[model samples]
Target chain A: MDTQPFYVAALDGLFGSFPTDADSLWVMLIGSLVGASCALVGSFLILRRLSMLGDAISHAVLPGIVIAFLLTGSRNIFPMLIGAGALGLLTAFLTDSLHRYGKLQSDASIGVTFTWLFAVGVILISRFAGQVDLDTDCVLYGEIIFAPLDVLIIGDNEYGPRAVWMLGGVTLANLLFVVFGYKQLKVCAFDPELAASLGIKVSLWHYLLMGAVSMTTVGAFESVGAILVVAMLVVPPNIAYLLTDRLGLMIALAVFFGILSAVLGYWVAYWLDASVAGAMATVSGLLFVLVALFSPTHGVIARVVAQRRLGSSTIEFADSAPS
Target chain B: MNESSDLPPWLEFFTFSNVNVTFVFLGCVLLGMSTGVLGCFAFLRKRSLLGDALAHAALPGVCAAFLLTGTKNPLIILGGAMVSCWMGALSVELIVRYTRCKEDSALGMVLSVFFGVGIVLLTYIQRTGEAAQAGLDKFLFGQAAALVDRDVWTLGILSVLILVVVAIAYKEFKLFSFDPEFAAGIGLPVRLIEIILATLIVVAVGIGLQAVGVVLMAAMLVTPAAGARYWTERLGVMLVAAGSFGALSGGLGAYISYLSPKMPTGPWMVVAATILFVISFTFAPRRGVLPRVLRHFRFRRRTAEENVLRTLYLLGEPLGQWNDSFSTNELLQYRSMPTAQLAHTLNRLIHKALVKEPAQGRYALTDFGVTRAARVTRLHRLWELYLTRKLEIAPDHVHDDAEEIEHILTPELELRLEALLEHPDEDPHASRIPGRFVPGESGG
Candidate 1:
């Protein structure tokens, strides 16, 4: 029986009574992998200064999935995802094009595009209630509460949350892409104009990066939900930004932070018996705000503490060490 | 309204279908006027997006007002929206002024943290699930249809008051926007003026939250200013144009949304403003694509004519010669076929005696052509020298642009460049400087 928080399932009852220890193990394992992937993808988005773009994409992808269902006439995961992916690409293209050729400001383009897409989606759902079921209950928070139901059934009893598998696949693909083109992506991210002068096709890199973001978002949405995915994508990378100067380290720290948020979010959600996605997103946002205000390099509290430490250390070192 | 054409009978906007609809349009016009006027100053100051952050900041105030009054009076909510928006504005100003964070970071920080708090409060309210909490969530995504006539009247009056304040302070706002340092030097109360400007922004944003919502209200403020910028450089013209654009968009959006029932008017207004920017970007006379293309086409024609004259001059013909001007087909045989259009261009030149068909197959340079060609070549070599010496252009970088510029150099600019380069006779590779045949300066 699971008689502990998933992380402490190896011991005994810690926070909650689990009927099965294996269930808690599954939760921890799945949550960590999902968190790691969200964090890794989030790093580049934050660094590229498209952190809010993640927020927009997550919302816009909703209508895509809905449209996909209308076309494919089924709720199978893959077709629904493909439809969402296409919509995500369209939103990114429109947003980018508006900022470029349309001469609209980046924020306004983002603001208008996502809201329009969302409104259209909402209107469609209201108008075509019989055709689709994009219930607010399911889309906003996700069915992570029901994630364990759709296990890939083998012969007998070999079951797990279907979401974990989808997110795992996405996470691996994202890792492979970043690893293969880390150098090119880094240069392009830092300075697009200079990268162009060096003969890098900056536009191609932009589409590729946007594609990766879209994929990660859809996968994360399945695992957590659209709202939580944004928090997962935006918060960890932002926290990592506070921690380090190096991109690689920032990415690594972001993943670490992401896992922490996921584990915390799960317990919080369980404790409150509320929407897991909402709790996860809330917890993730709190982590970021805390890091923004208190991380060592630039945090307010860190600065004050560092100053006090410096004052005492200087006096001690001056008496003991040679100048 | 024409919008009624697109709607079902129950929702069709008759004049009396709802007086609230008229109020929405009027309120939008007043908001448009104030924001357009205020936005001109913000746009000039490159702080157009500050309204965006301030708009987001209003969310907390909205939540706080909910917590305090337990009343749904639009007035109480707006008061709260103003307070939170100003607090957010102040936080941003503090971060920028007192800390090392750049504008983007400070803006991002204030926007996210404030909104996060609002979201948490909103979620808390939802979780509490009081029946009244139903409308509480509407603040995130606004409901313009829910607005009552009284609500619209309040917004309308507030907007008018802001419009009056802006009109009266137009000169003061203009002075600070264009040159705050100058205004301060002249003792114009720059800080107080900025504070007033900030307060005006908070008011416009608060009024807009009821009609359009918060996340996008900034577009109402900034888009008109940005679109107007493409049309005019004069401050007065830009302000008027922006106000006019805002008014039209507001009325159109309000009428359409009123008829359609489900469409959000504020976003539609932003879309309309974006269309205006698109029009201006392509059509503005001074920097437009059409004018630039026309300039380029004319320059090409002029340059091709000069090239024909230089070729005849080089071939030692006082009359324009056919050395460079074979038939149109012969001229088309060049490596880059694009250059062959120069023959059609050269034919235009022949009519001017810059080139002439002295024989059936040949063209010769006139006396005027001979001097102009020599002068073009002289200017070409002189510029190469100046680049390699004074500007320190690499030895290899000088040839490409000079090949294009030489044929188009005006006599006046050529004289000035020659003096700037101290009358150099040799290019980077020791080419000859074309001596100026300046009418009186020929003696010098």
Candidate 2:
């Protein structure tokens, strides 16, 4: 009852007994960076209407990481990331191909591809669960608490967690892609066939966009796990879309919403003594719902209000018209 | 032979030996039957894959129910899944009706957003450290091996209830699904019928959720329908075929995983269903690829014969004088046509008796051919006038349409077309119209 207040929960996490300063700051920074990365990439992803692919790739990355560990016999970040990203790319391509060539609908093709792929990963993890340190059950439901333990050092000053660095690198790469190909991506997203007719090479752009999503998603997967990664990709961009019409403004709003969710989620989780990823996803979901229902121009409330106004205007016009 | 034959009797056997296997088999068969019936309507309505979105939407529902009731009782969890899935279906329909977004986007957005919420709730449960929460996460990916007897009872009873509803409302559901515009015109409750169909699918998916998980539940509803589509166009046949396919796949997937202990049942079930789809995709009776290809080839051959007659009629003497016989070299050289193409055309002409070889390199049309050739040419000229005169097409548009229409134009349709055009003697280009086939006129 005493911890019901928001400010009290924030203060507790800031100087909590359980997680020391290093741990608290690192988890928050890594979580926010991962949050921002998913938002930035997800901005274009949602625009391209590829959020489902984002979900599939993120979840499907588990077996890739597991397989990478088995081959390299090392638990380092670089190899595992490359392996996972490759798997993500494969899932994206396979899903797109199945829809395009195999004539399966988007959800069915994606559902068939990912569940089968993830099932493979889970089975492998369960099989070698003893030998393999990381398991898919942990992967599907992420464990952000252990993230702070995997720290990266930069000389005597020391640096943030490895997850923060990975997510930061991905965020930087995603930002560059967005900036460099903004116009092309926009044109392609709007009318793909027109983009093709205009010689924009839509297939090339699609693969490029999907590659960026897979890369950033795999990087974030190491931190929040697959399920939370999906929430990050979907919720923030959707909130940003609710806030603005312009792509630039939308990305900014998404990053803002995402970072805001990370901070609030960490505090809420600390007070409630629950999972950080769950809090972040729930907060993000709450933000999305609020925006969906209340954004001035596009929200559900705005729609209903506009309908009423139109109804009144029609009657007035009808009364004034000459019979 | 068949891959199933290669396996040992123990592995290839259909059902489980003990009560565990029997219950699961019976439950899956009933589940398959229910979904197949509902899926027929869904597919007919062209929203074949909405079931996938609803299946994932059930996740947050189950989790929310757990949070409120503090129980993992099958009924409670099923209730939770049903509520959310129902909401998801509503949201999908609302988005499509309200927004300018295309159907795919509407489906994609609803699926992603609902699934995102489900993931959040699922992860929240795992992090809560509840003692009974061990198998709760399994709902996300489904684990058929864990399905006990009571679960089977719940699934079987629900399936029977749905089957009964489908049977009682068969006529209404069919008419509504196939042509709602007409059904509405006839005063049928199209909206209520659609709702019932959707509710049926939700119930079936909710039951399957325990065994297949969110990911595979969509396939359970769609793959069987897709596979069945190849075998028949009739609704009754399709429903039965899909149900059988679903049942067989579900049993095989469960039996495979049970025997191996390493593989999961859901994916294997999808594999079996996909295999059936592939079979149907290749070899279905009327619409199969092979039949389509053969039909296309035959049409092309027939079209070529008609074109040969039209060309002979245009180039030959007006009174059908030496039209049949033409030099092979001259034929190939006339339009820069390939020599092989000229040969193929000549061979077909000889086969059809329109043209013949009197001697080496000498060709002539029979009396039968010349009259037929003139009739075709007249049809072409008449169509040309009809296009330019009756249709008010430009002189340019008339020729392009007439060029193609002349060959396929049957005598009966041509007479009707000419009558409709009010009988013109000359085309827009001032070319003389050929005489019509009257009593005892040429080939008439």
Candidate 3:
């Protein structure tokens, strides 16, 4: 019966300047960066109808990261990146070959490959729980609140949370790839055959794009876990695709939505005292629903309204034409 | 560790002596059978991931059911899961139908978002520190060993119910999967049938959730059906094969989990199913990859031998003697095939008694070989003449098309082509067409 208003409490928690609040801020920052980078590559994936491939890659990278950690007894980013990238490309290639040669449908092939890899990763983790640093719970939901504790200190100069720096580098790399290869990616995604006829190596660009996705997935893995990474990779670009036509505008909108979801999700989690990754995914889902309903150009409500107006205008034109 | 140390030995795990292991194994077998059968429809409909979305969507339902009832009854929780998953499936259908979003994107959105809500609720319940909510997290990655006798009974009854429904409506489901429009045209309630099928899938997912969990339940639904597809083309046979494969995987998975107390049943079960899928993909008789590859290799070898025979026949033709032997060097001027490959083909032909070597370097067709060669040449010329005369293709273009067709033409097709060509004696290239030889008669 005695409770503060939800919005006031949420706002206070988001902007409050307590020492513990720094952790929430870092969590939000890392989430935003990861979300942005995921969206950057995810736009191309959605455009190419490879949205499920993003889901597949996110799940398939689990074994790669676990194996990488086992080989090197630390959670170093480089080995994880290399391992996950290799597996991600392998996921794409295997899905393609199974569909082409094994005569399996694309969806079935994806479902088969990712689940098998994920099962292997989970079995390995459970079997060697004492030796592995990561646990199944961490791999499933992630412990982003603890991420800030793992600070990157160089010669007593603290460079903030290691996740923040790792995600920052990933975002920069994704931005560079997109900026330099925008034209080729656009052509290849829209019309692969035309791009090939125009002398562009469609498959090379495809693998390059998947490599970017792999690296981004690995970077985001430690913070959000695999399923939430899938949400981040798919939800934002999908929302953006519903609202825009041009690729450049779509990418920009996707990044904007990603950041918005992260900030809003952080506040929601702080108020509810729940998992931040879950809150973020929830917010992204909510954002998508909102855009699907209200976007001025392609939204359900807008189209319905436009149709009503068109009906009246046509009636008026008919009345005038008869006279 | 202390608890597992007191448990039975590894070999005894399979003996059905332990009440708990027996119940768990039976429950998993039933779960696998129902999901496998229902998944065949999903796979054929090209919506194989629907089960996955439905599984993830059931998470919040389980949590909500627990929060509301404050109990951990499997049936109650499963009921809640079915409702929630059905809502997710319906929303996906609505989204794809009304909006520009495709099914894959819609599936991804529903799966992650609903799971997110479920995670929030689950964490909320865990924080509340209710003793009743202790085993709720097991639904994420299932703990099959925790299944009691009552839970197993509940799962078995539900699975059998699903199987009965599918059995009674087999023809309807078959018609719906192969061609829904025709079913609808015939006044069948196509939409209702689809909903029934979708509900069956969700029910299967709901029951399996406690054993396989949400993350890997899709594997149970997809892998068995996919593996079964390689062994048969009949719907009935595929469904049965898939069910057996699923049951086998489930039993093996439960056994493995029993062997090591720390291991989860869901992943091991998935691993077992994947092994079966790999076996089917590699070794099944008709549609398996190995057989298809072998068939391709055999066809390639046959084509090579036929090409060599045609070449020798043509070379002997220019000398005005069909039975004359020709040297390998002399044959090389007309055909550009690799020498080693040509020699291998020659050896195979000799082994078949189609060709014989009179000297070390010279080869000639035997009486049987001449008759076979004339028949092959007749079919090739007939095709070339058909293309030039009926299709109006130029002579040069007809040769390339006829070259590939010459190896695969069946006898019935050759007869049809001969009848269509009115038994032409010459091709468009002004070369004489070989005719069939009677056994006692010389070359006509």
Candidate 4:
């Protein structure tokens, strides 16, 4: 009975008493913040069709983090952000260069560039195993459970987990960036040439958006890990996309779903006694599946029903109606 | 082997008789080769990142297999990996085909989500305290040093199977890669072939997981093929080159890890493959950056020289003095080329024995230069005439188009243009179109 399967355990926890402990609250807060920040920036990434770029930046930031650790001899947030931000931009630049100048296909260029950078990062971690506190597994799947333990003690006054403060700051920054740059980002995403003709620097907005994504990814990385950060970046936004036609609504919905998954995922992890970040990502995936199949406007089921309704309509009306 | 142990560490590492090293080396090479071969299909289909998605998606499958069988059997685990990888691939296809999600988004979503799920399953397994579940986490980042004889044999057999399937279905795959619609029109079973190739890729990714791990397996599949593309135009040549590159990187990566006990094998393999990609991208004969840049430079220089010679001919046109001298300033007035460039072009022409500095700061066309200049003028005029008379573009609009084409027109194109226009004698602006350069003839 103690060795209950994961699904059964998860079901039990869903109906069972919810953990209201401070630690669990802290974990859920950090998770939701990470989710919100990632979703805010990821909406723009999906709009730009640069979702893979988000993935690439997430992986490629590893070496930057490692190098920053080596140079600073500490895991201070600012240096890590700067290092990872620079490397994130470099990954974007290199992938673009390889695609445009080197004439490699976009996917291959992306695949080659990030994996190479990630490999270098792994080697650095292994070579400096003694000095570096990071490992490949930790980079892939983070230690969210220990977030509360790494308390930010400022001169004997104990604050909560550092991740909460870091993620909150990032989420706020991402919110501001997205809110302020809405018009510019929308134009640039929908039509770069038109945006350029309108005197908006498309590349500037591009890098700015990429910069925001990098910061969000780095902030979320401690709680969700790099791979799950990608999930947070892509899945919720896509789910929102399926539900809405307006960009503003889409972004809002994405953030809503993101936080929903985060809280639900914490409970799931609690029930299954597994990784919190992974459960969050899985819950998001399941959410996306649900929305994809059942959204009113764009869901698969709606489309099929619409098709059947059209098929049964009068021929003259059906012929007159534009597809 | 015992005697070799007393040798220096570096020397001792290279001795092939060491059984463990042999197994590791063979496993990686075979893994590299198979992935490289399967990657071509994916790359051609523009699905390079699909390999990454499949690799990441395999993790939960691996954990699920261990949980189901409660054994550490490699075959069973890999079997589970294939099933889930196939499922991931199917999900990607479904999302792209039926939904509004773009392929890239679908790939990213599936990749990260499946990997997350896998992480959940793996962590669950760890908490369960399954005795046989030791070292399952190695799939996260492969530990190639743990390769034994049985693993080597499995990798070897799988590599051969991938190679054989690719070879036997070579024609179908080539058709499928280049033009699926045409292949289907010709009665080929396009769907079945796609499934087969997808299966092959799934297996290739499956085999590579233990050697290269989930994150890097995409590099093994993509880098070799991408590097090989820069080196060859033919599909057959690309496959061979990619396979060789894959094998070379695998062996090199294995050796590097052998030398440094602390360094992991998978990353080094990726690094080695990337080094090869960089080399190929830079230095391959035709498609490489170096040659492409060289070609562009050469073309620019030729355009400049030809423009100068054509200007000299136009300047001398009214007087009919093909041998008349012209200063740099005079040439720039007619051509708008930079003054310094005109002088440099004159010097190059002098070296070619086509133009001579009859006086300081002044140039004259040699007999050869007049003939070459006439050829350029003629092609320029013929294109203008063709455009105005046949395509109905304004004569003014034709000159700008002809300016670009005059430098690029091959001799065959020049002849074709002349024949099409019936060797017209004058351009739209009333400038006489010069004849083809005949070495012994008088200058036009």
Each candidate's TM vs. the true structure? 0.78, 0.79, 0.91, 0.92
Candidate 2 lDDT, B1-444, residue by residue in tens: 124355664654543445676776677667766776677777776676677668867878988989888898878888998998888888777765654334444455566557656656666677677677767756766777777898888888999999899889988887887788999999998878877877888888888888777656776777787767767768888888988888887777766676666677766776666667667656777655567667778877766666666566555644545454667665544444556766787787888787888889866676566666667767877887777676777778776677677667887997897788777666677755566742122433
In the range B1-444, model 3's lDDT, one tens digit per residue, is: 125445567767755777788888888888888888988999998888888888889988989999999988777888888899998999888778776777888888888888888888887888778778877777656767888888798889989999999999999999999998999999899889989998888888888888777757989988999999999999999999999998998888888887788888889988999999999999999799999999999999999988888887888776556678999998888888899999999999999999999999999988888778777787788899999999999899888888899998988998898889888778999877887663222333
lDDT per residue for candidate 4 within B1-444, as digits (tens), equals 346367776777677768888889888888888888888889999888989999989989999999898987888988999999999988998999889998889999999899889989989999998777778877656778877888889889989999999999999999999999999999999989988988898888888888778768989999999999999889999999999989999998998998887888999999999999999999999999999999999999999999988888889888888789988888877879776787788889999988999889889999989889888888888899999988999888998999999998999998888888887777888777776765222433
DockQ of 4: 0.66
lDDT of 3 by residue, A1-323 (tens): 13977876775667552224678789888889988999999899877766777677777777887899899989887887778778888888887777778899878988888888888888988887898888667655666667789899999799899989988999999999999999999999999999999999998998899889878876787666766677878889989988989999999999999898888877777777777788888999999989999998888999899999999999999999956
Clashing pairs in 4: none
Against the true structure, whose lDDT is highest? 4
Question: What shift in Å separates residue B433 of candidate 4 from its native position after superposition?
Answer: 1.6
Please, what is the whole-model Cα lDDT of each candidate in the order they appear? 0.69, 0.73, 0.84, 0.87
The whole-model C-alpha lDDT of candidate 4 against the native structure comes to 0.87
Report the lDDT tens digits of candidate 1 across residue range B1-69.
445466664456544454566667777777776777777776776666667667767776887888788
Fnat of each candidate: 0.00, 0.18, 0.65, 0.88
lDDT minimum window of 10 residues, candidate 4 chain B: B435-444
Question: Residue B59 error for model 3, in Å?
Answer: 2.5
How do all the candidates rank in terms of lDDT, highest first?
4, 3, 2, 1
Q: Write the per-residue lDDT of candidate 2 for residues A55-120, one digit (tens) a residue.
A: 678667877989998888878778888888899888988778766755555655665566556656
Models ranked on DockQ: 4, 3, 2, 1
Error of 1 at B31 (Å): 3.0
Writing each residue's lDDT as its tens digit, candidate 4 over A1-323 gives 68878887886656565678999999888888888998998998898777887778888888998999999999776787788888888898898789889999998999999999999999999999999998766665667878888888899898888888888899999999988999999999889999999999988998798778877887778565787688889999999999988999999999999999989888889988999888998999999999999999999999999998877786768788999
First chain TM-score for all predictions: 0.84, 0.88, 0.88, 0.89
